[model samples]
Target: MKENRSREMYEEIKNITKTFQPRLGVIKDEKGNILTESKQIVDRWKRYCEKMYSSDSTADQQEKLEETREDKEINLLPLRSEIEWAIGSLKDGKSPGCDDI
Candidate 1:
């Protein structure tokens, strides 16, 4: 019967998933030592994010942006009507993008 076949297929899929082991590559720290423990991995990632997104970088980035703006002549600004048309052209009810709309 169709019900029996569906049940067999579900059981086969369950067994396959139960045996599945994702192959994760090795992660290391700044000292070039392999990190195996979950806590160590989490801590390493935390440290990396903290270093990458430190508060002092914001002011430095703003200064660099101002310098770049002063050095470059920007003439590719889109008109407000063009931007509205672009937004209106997009279909609704779709999945949100990376910035979540």
Candidate 2:
């Protein structure tokens, strides 16, 4: 019947996530120390994700697009009568925006 009630609700949510044991409660460090074991909270989340994606310098610190100026004027091509007035203001079977078209 609905695939055996979705395979008995996926084996009762995989045996309630195999007896579930997730608490990760204490974790502090960055000199403030606390942690609490499970291998020092997995080596403090692998040294805070390797110091948040380690990058001392692979150059390009940014800034040049002719040094940057345009506080306003930014047309970048839309006008075909503004894409036919946004497909004539959408409404038949709606949903399209967020590039979901």
Identify the leading candidate in terms of TM-score: 1
lDDT tens digits by residue: candidate 2, 1-101: 46559888888889988866898678988888898878888888898887666663222223334345444457778879999999999889867567643
Write candidate 1's Cα lDDT for 50-100 as tens digits: 877888877788889999999987887999999999889888976556654
Clashing pairs in 1: none
Top lDDT model = 1
Candidate 2 stretches with Cα past 4 Å from truth are 1-6, 35-47, 50-52, 56-101
Clash pairs for candidate 2: none
Candidate 2, lDDT over the whole model: 0.73
Q: In candidate 1, where is summed lDDT lowest over 10 consecutive residues? A: 92-101
Whole-model lDDT values for every prediction: 0.85, 0.73
TM-scores, one per candidate:
0.45, 0.25
